[model samples]
Target: MNVSLILIILLVGAFATYLAGDKLASKVALLFSIASLGFSIVLLNQYNLGENINFINQWINQPNVSFALNADGLAIAMLLLTTALTPIIIYSSFRNEYKNAKSFYALILFMAFAMCGTFLAADGLLYYIFWELALIPIYFIALIWGNGDVEERKKAVVKFFIYTLAGSLFMLVAFIYLYQKAGSFLIQDLYNLNLTASEQLWIFLAFFLAYAIKIPIIPFHTWQANVYQKAPTVGTMLLSGIMLKMGLYSVIRWQLPIAPLAAKEYMYIFIGLGIAGVIYGSIVALRQRDLKKLLAYSSLAHVGLIAAGSYTLTIDGLRGAVLQMIAHGFVVVGLFFASEIIYRRYETRVIAEMGGIRSQAVKFASLFMILVLASVALPTTFNFVGEFTVLYSLSQINVWFAVLGGTTIILGAYYMLKMYQHVMLGETNTKPFADVTFNEATTLVIIVAVLFFFGMYPKPITDLITPSLENIITQINRIN
Candidate 1:
């Protein structure tokens, strides 16, 4: 299938960049990422034709595993997110020089390959393999090339790695049991399993642990802020932009359909926990003084709402969840990259240490302001579209659910505007604050274009995603 070619280009590009050496690694990586994005767009065009992009091959005899990759609309949407962001990630990093540049860029490409596989794999066993595969490069990316104290960074990255990997074990057990029942690791076969409520409850819990920890729900999110604060900017963008979506995507693709009974039964619990994260993240972000940590919490708040949307299990909720995910991917990366921009210029991330950037760097301040408002979900920004859809979906379930989650509208504005005022609008700081460079401007411009373009005209995305989500709802309802 054509999707396999996309993976091939990424895998080969990873090694090719390493071979290209430090002198040309970053350029090579950027070129490859752009090419990957091009191919992903091609895949998107072919999606409506109902082309067979599913490729199956023998992998393991004992587990009955096969190498299967399929590109449905859901998978393609995730792929678009991955490929679109990779070029921007690499381009943004062109401003920073990392030691072992080849390995660094190569790891980025390898991570893309793994994430693409995670989205495309049609076999449950294959998906599990790729799921674990996606974690390796980010670990080393943050461990070796990351900023902050080495020992502390080590602890943070290790905690993040172990926490996510540990949660994945429970999911493996669920997959194994499903294999025993279905005698096939294919996703469709697992979806067909007639699980009793007891089995669905246990299986749902197993999947919930994995997705919850990755999404870093309220209680499971201890490692998130530290990791985001400590990791390199490129690493942070990947983690927040695409990797976290992996968890949310799993809920739509695997957890809900396969465990329809438990999902419907315990929908309130997922919604409650997700809503709790929304408030908890907002209140904590209100007091955060470090810029990156605040954005980390902001990310928690945004995704918390996305998680709530998914738990609603309606076409509207699921649609809003996926759309918001794509929206947050662009917005969060821009916001985090903005922090990186400030860190490089002012040599500080402490909010109090930064002031009056706009007095000198007017253009940078203006762009930064747009992202801030977008994160706050200002009307006429893409974030508002997703936020409105999700809140409406929640309201349909229960008005109070909408009320609790909607507090982000108020608190998000408070924290984000407060940070903007402190970082960009206060009286002039003594330190030199420069405007964003050409490459940095290019990245931010692309992100802003996507946001506002979709903000005013969201029909294309909603049209593409609605049919698939409707199909998912149909499968889920019929199963129960």
Candidate 2:
């Protein structure tokens, strides 16, 4: 009934999948991932019924940290998103044959375990440990199973490893400093600290350095495209769909609450940076010839807007960011899976070479088009609900912020549609490109179903997250 059960399931599943051998690895991983998703639903029901599901126990007494896993509505929402997408990502990989398949599938479940812990952990040190643990499996996944030249892949993966690791150290330093002052690493304890303006600013900047690099907003985004292009499709899916949200989630859960003054003082500056990322990512995506790299840039742009929303310090902003986090997670995974389907058939990711796919693959093109529309925030799609709320929040701050952030719609539609034109529309391709099979079609259908269903009825999500977000706003406003 407690949150630790989900973590235990994933950890045990990782080992079970590995032992099942290459022949059964994918199936075992999928089964376990689905089980986690099912159990997450059960926990959600318990939470709705007002049962206590959070776990906290004393650990590391000298530093006064607890082994805490808190499942507030916001954290549960994120946990559900992580759990929901994991099986789809794994299922999407079933068609491709991987070397060392056992390890490949095992790592996917392990990464899920780490990400779930990251979402649930309520102690700062525990959260950081989970955050860093999520990185290790992805590093090996990208370095071993990724595409492109071996040397080039190594360079890209290593850069990502070093870049994120270094940024995280700053966050660790911030945590250590806070622990010194507060004598405990519990989130509630840190949030209660009334630090001076200078202290808050330093802490804010330290946390910003870590999150901005992970979120990779604008100037800190150098490591993104290369890694996305080099990593395998499933690796890319995990990074884009679930991992990127960790930074934005932390901004809401930790940064703004703990350093409300600095966040308030420098709000416009940080929001400006996020808006800048939106414009930059959109423009760069227009120029990408490789499909994955283009999608990577598009992801950067979407998260940028989400980041800007979180900084707005309004319930609308934080809630919209969380909603968009879930929406973007599903859409981006679908887009990448669509590309992977093409790569499997055409054996090329080059946009110049792909054309007339729709003629041969009606179902795939249809599903892909829906995903593209969702990505561009077309009305009635889940993305539109999130994107519209985020823009509205930006507008309340400054019309110009809203104006510039709106460019994602115009530019996004341009590049995404244009990419679709070249890749899916045109005269029938000379080469044979098969349509997606039942497995592939099923995956895309599930994603599309979730998007449309939520798009029409977002109340369930809004209701679940609103109170938690309001509490965060109260905390952020408490000292200031």
Candidate 3:
């Protein structure tokens, strides 16, 4: 079967979930998500065996656009992350009672479908369509199901919508220009263009605007904390865990390849911006009294490092970025899930309102502690592998970049450990804080297991992504 099969499954699953009505929505969604995951596994096996899984067909003849889904090892890795996490994310929400549950779960599946399409689309216009499609579901999901004041949530969601949409238009323009120059919107065609250095610089800037706003690096990150805090936990997980990676992945897959000269020429500036985000996000996270907001800032820090690694134009840098992206995805979701669990018991997001939970819920405390350590990139955790590789790559460029980027681990450890102590330790809360239920424990255990397993044996992922990353690196240095 072709790569499009996975997309079809998720798309149909969204409709099936909505038709199942509110009562059966979660179960239906989870079942379909698992099916998609299973299919992806089968596809992976086929891919490894040298079967043709890529799909492409003419869509717009005049514009020369094609509906293409290229399932190379890199795309497959991202597709697997989206498919695998979709089930966990859906099952995790089984604990909460959302109103109009059918629509909520349907939106989740639809978003997953769009995200998978984004990862797989090999045509520029087609990829843009999927990219924008992913935004619509999340907008409604956050605006409708999100917690907090109505006005604030609306403002946050709307602003995020406008910011990302506005930035994306610049990318669309760049694509249109490339289509005119190359007479095709295919990725490989654009990659083959012999543009002037000036053209590459403008195109590079256009893409940087879109990716920066989405990745929300530094000054462009104003909307992130508010949106993260206001959106429901599910939306937060989708955003921090998977959606943010879209931008980072695009840098490797689209931006650098299309404008290799610009990427190489201005590498240090972009890397500096990413490093700035690292320092800024860490310092801000240190002061956040709100747990989700703290996690949100923490995400900002991690992605910044990932971005820096991607821009380094080295195999280690790109490979490390991909590894960290996957590692961060699972750990961040687990951390946010921990917050949701605490909120369930106490119905509060304020760190001050939580205390002595460890005494009452030993299982939860231990799991949350593992997630925290994973976040700070503890040795033997998946995060450490990625972080060490990224830091090493940065050092290859400039030792000081490595030193500054390394603050994420140091400041990250201090803030996360301090957060865990205040929220889980000290005097027991008067309210009965029950231990994690079977479902909750299952989700965290799965995430933790993946982290530790990959941390020790990352050869599989490294092997999967390295060749693709090396090709991109070759493209970046082709002129040199």
Per-model TM values vs. the true structure: 0.99, 0.99, 0.99
lDDT of 1 by residue, 75-154 (tens): 88899999999999999999798999999999999999999999999899889988999999999999998888999999
For model 2 the TM-score comes to 0.99
Evaluate all candidate structures by whole-model CA lDDT and list the values in order.
Answer: 0.93, 0.95, 0.95
Error of model 3, residue 478, in angstroms: 1.5
Candidate 1 global CA lDDT score: 0.93
Model 2 root-mean-square deviation: 0.7
Candidate 3 stretches with Cα past 4 Å from truth are: none
Clashing residue pairs, candidate 3? none
Error of 1 at 199 (Å): 0.3
